[model samples]
Target: MAGQRGTRVAGADLVDLLTRAQRALVRDLGTVLEEEGCTVDQWRVLRALAAEERSMGELAAALEIPHPTLTRVVDALVDSALLYRTQSEEDRRRVSVHVSPLGRTKLNRLESLAAAHERALATRIGPETVTRLTDLLRDLP
Candidate 1:
C-alpha cells in the first residue's frame, strides 16, 4: 500500500512537470505565431488546413480543439480570407475548409518561422539530444 501511494505521488509529479514544460514551450512558440498574426490555436488550424480541404469535424479532431472553439476560429479565418468554407457536395449539412492562396502564402511564411524556431531549440539542446527528445515525446503515454 505504501509503495502504491509513493508511485501515485510520483506520477502526479510527472504530470505537473509535463504540464509546466508544455506551457513553457507553448509560450515560446506563441510569440512567433503572434508575430505571424495568429494565436497558437489559429496556427494549428491553419497548419492542418494547409494540406487539403477538411470538414469542420475533421479539423476539430485533427487539432484537438473543441467544436465550438473551432467554429469560431474557422469563422474568423474565413472572414480574413485565409480560409474558405464550402458545403460538401454530398452533404449539405457539412462544411469543408480550404486554405486560400493568401493563406498558403501565410502558411509558407509561418513554416519558415517554425523551422527557425525548431532549429534554435535544437541548438540550445544539442542536435542529438533534440532527436532523442523528439523520439521520447512521440512514444510518451
Candidate 2:
C-alpha cells in the first residue's frame, strides 16, 4: 500500500526517516558547498572548530565522525591553510585543531550561503513548519 501524504508508513522507523532526511538535506547543501571548494564533512569540521579549538578525540565524538575519517578531513583542511594543529599545552601527548584566519573568512562566506539556502527551504516549506520541525528534532534523544 502507498503511504499517505504527511503520514508514516507501517514499516517505517524513526532511524530510516532521519537518515533519509539527512541525506536529502546534505545533498542539497552539498551543491552550495561544492561551489566554495569544500565538502560537507569539511564544512562540518570548519563549523565545529569556529567556536574553539578541540582535541581530535573530542572533535570526533562531538561531530559523530569516526576518528580516522575526521583525521583525514582535518588533514585536508590543514593542507588548505584553513586549519592548523598545535601541541596541547596541558598534555604533551595530545594535539588540538583550530580554524585559521583564512578558515574564518571562508566560514563567513559559507555561513551566508547556507543561510540563504535555509531561507529558500523555509520559503518552499512554510517557515512555521520548518521551525516546528527543527524544534521537534532538537527535542529528540
Candidate 3:
C-alpha cells in the first residue's frame, strides 16, 4: 500500500514535468512556424492534407479545432496555394480538401525542419530520454 502510494505520487510528478516540457516544445515550434509565415494550427492542417484528402468536418475533427476556426485556417491555406477544395461526387455539399503540389513541398520542408529540431533535442536530452518521453506521452490520457 505504501509502495503504491509512492508510485502514484511519482507518476503525478512525471505528468507535471511532461506537461511543462510539451508546452515549451510546442511554443518553440509555434515560433518556428510563425517565422515561416504560418500558425501551428495552419501547419497542422497542411500536415493533415499531406496524408490524404478529407472533408472540412474531418479535417476539423482531426485537428481538434472547431468548424468556424478551421474554416479560417482552411481559407488561409487555400489562399497560400497549399490546399484546394472540391465537391464530393456523392454529396455535392461535402467539400473534400487535398494538398496542392505547393502544399506538399511545404509539408516536406516542415518535416525536414522538424527533423533538424529533433536532432537538436536529441543532443540536448539524449535519445533515450526522447524515446521514454515519447512512450510516456503516448500512454498519457
Candidate 4:
C-alpha cells in the first residue's frame, strides 16, 4: 500500500512537471507567433491543414480541440480569407476546409519563424538534450 501511494505521488509530480514545461514552451512560442498575428491554436489549425484538407470533425480530433471551439476558429479563418470550406459533392452535409493561397504564404512565414524559435531553443538547451527530451516525450503513452 505504501509503495502504491509513493508511485501515485510520483505520477502526479510527473504530470505537474509536464504541464509546466508545456505551458512555458507554448508561452514562449506564442510570443513569436504573435508577430505574425497568429495564436498557437490558429497556427496549429493552419499547420494541420497545410498538407491536405480535412473535415471539421477530423481537424477537431487531430488537434484535440473541441468541435465548437474549432468551428469558431474555422469561422475566423474563413472570414480572414485564410481558409475556405467546400461541401462534399457526394455528401452535402460534409464540409472540408482548405487553406487559401494567402494562408499558404502566411503559413510559410510562420513556419520560418517557428523554425527559428526551435533552433533558438535547441541552442539554449543543447541540441542533443532537445533531441533526447523529444524522444523521451514521444515514448510516453
Candidate 5:
C-alpha cells in the first residue's frame, strides 16, 4: 500500500511505524525529559560518557554524530556539571569527558523510568510481541 508520497503504508513492519511515530514520541519524551531537567541530546551525551572517558572526537565517532552538534550537547552537560571535560596532560590539544556522580544518578533514574515504561508497553502489546519487536530492532542494520 502506497502512502501519500508513494512510500509503503504498511504497519506490519515495526520500523516503518516506529520511524513515523518518532516525531510525536520525541516530543512527548522530550517533554518528560525536560521535566526531569534534561534534554534528549543531553541524555545521549550522558549515556556516551557513562561507559568510559572519551574525547570530543572519540565521543562523536562512538555516537556516529557530527562534531559541532555533539559539541553543543556536550557543552550543556559539561556546564551542568553532569559531565567533566579535562585536557590530557600529555596532549593539551585533546580533551576527554567523564560522567560525574550527579550524571550517574540521573542516568540511573532515567533507566528506571525506561524500564517501567517498557513493562507497561509490554503489558499492552503482549510480552512475546514486544520481545520480538525489541529483538528485530536490535538486529536492524
Candidate 6:
C-alpha cells in the first residue's frame, strides 16, 4: 500500500532509501562541519590524524576514500594549516601526514557536534531503534 491516499510508492529498494536518508542526514547535521570550514571528507581525515600520523595510502584505506580524492582533501587541509606532511626518515620517498594543533581543536568541536546530532536523532527515532539501526548498518555487506 502507498502512503496516505496511495500517492506514494511502497516498493522502494533499501539502497535507494538508504542513500536518500544519508544525504538528508548529512545535510541536516552538516552545520558544525561547515562552521569549522571543513568538508565531511576533510573532517574524516582530521579525525583519523587525531589518533596518529599516517601515510597517504594508509589514510585512504582507513577512510575508504579514493586515493586521488584523498589527495585533494589532504592538500586543502595542508594549505589551511590544519595538517602537515613530512617525509619518512627511513624512506625519503614516503610521506606521512599529521594533524596540527588547530586540526585537533576543530576535531574536538566536530566530535561534540556529532554527539549532539546523534542525540537529537536518537530522540527522533528512539534510542533503542538507533542502536538497532547502527548494528544493522555495521552488519551490512
Best prediction by TM-score: 4
Candidate 1's C-alpha lDDT? 0.87
* Residue pairs in candidate 5 whose N, alpha carbon or C atoms collide under 3 angstroms: none
lDDT of residue 19 for candidate 5? 77
For all predicted structures, in order, the TM-scores are 0.88, 0.90, 0.81, 0.91, 0.78, 0.84
The sequence of per-residue lDDT tens digits that candidate 5 reaches over residues 43-113 is 77788888899999998988787999998888888788889889999999999999999989998877666
Cα lDDT tens digits for candidate 3, 1-141: 888767677768777887898799888887777667777788789888887899999988887999999999999999999899999889899999999999988888777777777888889999999999789778866
Clashes of 3: 0
Candidate 2 on 5-119: residue-level lDDT in tens?
4577544767788899899999999998889999889988999999999999999999999999999999999999999999977889899999999999999989988898899
Write the residue-wise lDDT of candidate 1 on 67-120 in tens digits.
999999888888889899988779899989999999888888888888888899
Best by lDDT: 4
> CA lDDT of 136 in candidate 2?
98
Total clashing pairs for each candidate:
0, 0, 0, 0, 0, 0
Which regions of candidate 2 deviate over 4 angstroms? 2-12
**Best to worst by lDDT, what's the order?**
4, 2, 6, 1, 3, 5
TM-score of 4: 0.91
Using TM-score as the yardstick, the better of models 4 and 6 is 4
The deviation in Å at residue 123 for candidate 5 is: 2.6
Better of 2 and 6 by lDDT: 2
Candidate 1, residue 133: Cα displacement in angstroms equals 1.6
Residue pairs in clash, model 4: none
Candidate 1 off by > 4 Å: 1-8
lDDT of 2 at 110: 90
Query: 1-141 in candidate 6: lDDT tens per residue?
Result: 446636645455667899999998888777657876778788889988898999999999999999999999999999999999999999998899999998888789988887888999999999999999999999996
Over 4 Å off, model 5: 1-18
